[model samples]
Target chain A: MTVIRAALLGFGTVGQGVYEAIKTHQKRLQERLGKKVEIAGVLIRDLRKQRSLPKHILVTDNIEDILAIDDLDIIFEAIVGNEPCYTYLNQAIEKGCHIITANKAMFAQFGTKLLEKAKQHRVQVGFEATTAGGVPIIRTIEQLLQVNKIEKVEAILNGTSNFILSEMRKNKLSFPDALQLAQERGYAEADPTNDIEGIDAFYKLMILSELIYGGQPEWRTVEKQGIRTLTSEKVQLAEQKQKRYKQIASLTKKDGKVLASVKPILVNKAHPLYHVEDVDNAIKLETSLIGTFTLQGPGAGKLPTASAMVEDFIYVLEKDKSIKQQGEVVYS
Target chain B: MTVIRAALLGFGTVGQGVYEAIKTHQKRLQERLGKKVEIAGVLIRDLRKQRSLPKHILVTDNIEDILAIDDLDIIFEAIVGNEPCYTYLNQAIEKGCHIITANKAMFAQFGTKLLEKAKQHRVQVGFEATTAGGVPIIRTIEQLLQVNKIEKVEAILNGTSNFILSEMRKNKLSFPDALQLAQERGYAEADPTNDIEGIDAFYKLMILSELIYGGQPEWRTVEKQGIRTLTSEKVQLAEQKQKRYKQIASLTKKDGKVLASVKPILVNKAHPLYHVEDVDNAIKLETSLIGTFTLQGPGAGKLPTASAMVEDFIYVLEKDKSIKQQGEVVYS
Candidate 1:
């Protein structure tokens, strides 16, 4: 059995979840893949801080320790933001190490460049966890787009916004109350500007657009709207009309041009997005060959997000094996 | 590029869709897989029927055409029902030709035996298109179960039943009217007993159980319920209570025992399945690692079902390559 050596870049919520998942499902993973995956190192901001982790696994604050590891096959980047994650990923790629990341901010800006670089280095870079947590939307779309022409990709991509909206509709709470409830429940961050202002969804939309449509729509080109403008009266009115308010992010290809947007729309009770409440996300794809396909799941959470990262890890391992077996094949 | 030769058994809806999908997406498939997949021959019950097929493609009524073909790498059985499809798949396995099928009935009954035979013969058997059409649920579950312990899998597996329920909820139609409307829309067959009686969902549930949970839930063991018992009064009452009715098929591993059932349940406006109306099917899987993950799509349509067949073909091809590369591995 092949043994894949991996390292975690950030030991945060998702990173810790990945560690737990790997430990909890080690035997199952080994049986399924006919290989053992071992974590060689973990990189965090603080080295002195105590963490719920095995002492046998090396923990370091320096990037050089992870980058310099000769046996490290892949890097799992659960770090937030762009600058340092991008730098670490680039270094990993340069070292001919494959990567799986849940960082959407870096991907939204530098995905193409990273993909190109990985291709140049003959390595894999998977970003399935960067989207809808455990929905498998990225891989599903990759499969569908291989056989079908996708016309429109629509999704309730942001769980925080969706939770806030669902709360507003159900409890008739004002935007402030709903946001506060979300933050208190740990669904929203203390500063939830990226989610509430639609920037998070916008970033996801940009990533999906680039992936499915093959190029990013200029961020400013998207007609940005958020759930913040929704009032309690509007929420109540939607409920009265048997509708639920949802923030929808959509990317459509029309005449070879991609149109992307993020907005709060009142979907009727019959619409699928109307029922996806709380910290759940749903994506609906309209393709030429297969018509419509939708996937829903926990959009953001410790386990679900980490499961996605594990999926990407498995994908990278499989791709690595395939490439090794069939040299000079264009995998991407 | 490696070229894989294949044969198609049956010229039914799914078979024709596979043919057309292959022809339409040949370039993309070749680019992605680094191989050209060609249909070497087609097995049909009657060759005199007026069918639109490429003249270069040979159409024959005899199974010998597929069996005798020396270069055929795989056989795609799109034939419905048990006896003939099973016989042909077994023949393919014996002949050392990998098999792909959209025949759920055969798989539901004899998947273990067939997979054992394939393993013995060093071949592959793919049945992705058999359940949930083109949603790729089987593959997703296979991947997830490899890395996580699945707790439960609940799904609106049959599209016909989901359509009837959705129509009943939306248009306030009686069960009979809704079913008739489904037939009129081509979502249901003339003899819709298998679909409406919950047998279809049962079969899919069995497949899921075997594939993910590693054992088949006895067909009779599952408490089966269908939409025929649903009344418009209940639909009205559900709407009055701000709920919707959905036909749900579920399999759960609880306390080391497998529990499986197909029944109609009342879900409030908050449930994702509530909004999955009009021929749409949704599946929710609760796992130890991924929490709750749901997939919704056109469960049974001409193209969607056909897309699944294509996926099965690709899966077979990839697995065949892998098995050939790896001399022998213990089968779990």
Candidate 2:
């Protein structure tokens, strides 16, 4: 069987999930691609740590080890930081390998540059997991842009913040208590600074803005206010009036300038974003053609994020096949 | 400039909308495809009728006039019926021209046959507008199927029936009164048999079923019940219980069999379809990888349907370009 050799840049939650998904759905992947997807190497922080990977696959702490793999077809990067992930992806692209990443922070900062490098190298870059996990918002936006102009985009891009706000409103709990519950459920990190301080949503919003408008607002000028100071009383009062408080990341182009913001807004019942609660994320796009289009699903998770990457991998393979073959293509 | 010669099979609402969309987005289309889209011919029922088309375009009552167009790359079919539309599409496919259609009734019956013929002729058939007009459910499903198995699909596929049901509950109107209001608002046709009797939703459901499962229930075996018999009192009672009556078309795979139905189902507030009101349509897909993903939008409108067809046309062009070009491809 023809095998596409791939490497993983991190063995964290998303990386492990991607590996497991490839294992569990190997048959389906083979059936769709007509080729086997093999994980040739994995780059981890600690080589001493035990992993349940097959013995034939190489696990290393050095990025150079994975980059040295012969005929490496793709790279899946799930590292948390912005420095090495960006540099590593550039290196992979230089080696003519398609790359898929879940590193939102790194992507938000250097996504446009990375895309240009990938373009110049004639390799694909899949970042669907960088914005909204499992919702396919990136792909949806691309398809919508083919025939329609997106006038406005309002979205709940951070699952942790949305979950915290929803818990506060639904359980009438204080912000701290709701955040504690979120941590207990693994929705929020130990520090929770990035998620609760609106920085996470800001990154995702910038990613979306760049995709839709082909540019983004100046980072410091983009207003971002998180939900740490919102009181339980305010949430309850809003609920009494049939309104809900949600963390909304919005982008609108006016006067040929893209205005972007990430803040907590009280939404009415008629608003599509009002019902989007808990760990679920939703995006409402007001387009030039379709009046209002909404898509909602799990914003972030091991499987959902991994599923996005796997789907991107399959898409890259299929698109690559179309360029190589002259006969009928099932999807194209 | 390189040009793609095209034709419109019907000049009804959807057909006219497609023409208008092409004209309005001509610049963007040319920018994306690097090819000007030219409407070389149009097949209409009345040859002498006034059409708001350019003088350079040919409008005809006969199909042969359209088939004779030189270098025809695509055909956009929006005709209402099953027989002549199917035959015309088959003929177009035989000419090795790509086709996009919004004819749900015809597609629900002969979609598989048409797809097979298109495959044989190496022509693409796009039926994105056949299921949920602006929701892009068909394309969403196709993308999801790449890495996930769809376990269940529940959707509001008809706007007229949903409008009547929403009005009946919201205004306490009788079924006939609500339907009359829908007709006045141009949401329903004068002959409301297909919409009110659930046949329209059934056809769309069948189309979705065929897309997902590659087969559908025997037509007679599918249980379909419309909202015509739903009483205002019942709707009010359900509303009091925080529920809504929606014309739901649902499909589930169990024990390796695909069970399908279209009916007026009372949905609780927690149900995704509960908040879908008026002419809005929503589809909830329960997939193996993504859990429950929902998309909501305008179910039917001139601009929305036309937007879908135009998007499909762009997709076909992009895919075809990838097959022909050996160098870099933007979307692929």
Give the top-scoring candidate (TM-score): 2
TM-score of chain A of 2: 0.96
State the lDDT of candidate 1 residue by residue for B1-332, as single tens digits: 37878899988887888888888889988987788989888999877899887886778998877799867788888888898778888988999898888778889999989999999998888888888887888888877765667888778889888888878877889999998998998889999999998999998889999987789756677899877888999989989998887889988887777899999888875565766777777788888877878888888877888887777777777777765544322231
On DockQ, the leading prediction is 2
Candidate 1, residue B84: lDDT:
77
Q: Candidate 1's error at B233, in angstroms?
A: 3.2
- Against the true structure, candidate 2 has what lDDT? 0.90
Model 1 lDDT, full chain set: 0.84
Query: What's the TM-score of each model vs. the native?
Result: 0.94, 0.97
Give the worst 10-residue stretch by lDDT in candidate 2 chain B. B323-332
After superposition, the stretches of candidate 1 with alpha carbons farther than 4 Å from their true spots are A1-3, A328-332, B1-3, B327-332
> Candidate 1 chain A, which ten residues in sequence have the lowest lDDT sum?
A323-332
Over B1-332, each residue of candidate 2 has an lDDT whose tens digit, in order, gives 39999999989889999999999999999999888989999999987888778788989999998999989999999888887888899899999899999999999999899989987887788999987897888888989988888999999988999999988888899999999999999999999999988899999999888889989989999999978789999999998999898889999878878899999888888888888878998999998878889999998999999999999999887776665553333235
lDDT of 2 by residue, A230-295 (tens): 999999999999999899999999999999999999899889988887899999999998889999
Candidate 2 regions off by >4 Å? A322-332, B323-332
TM-scores of chain A, one for each prediction = 0.96, 0.96
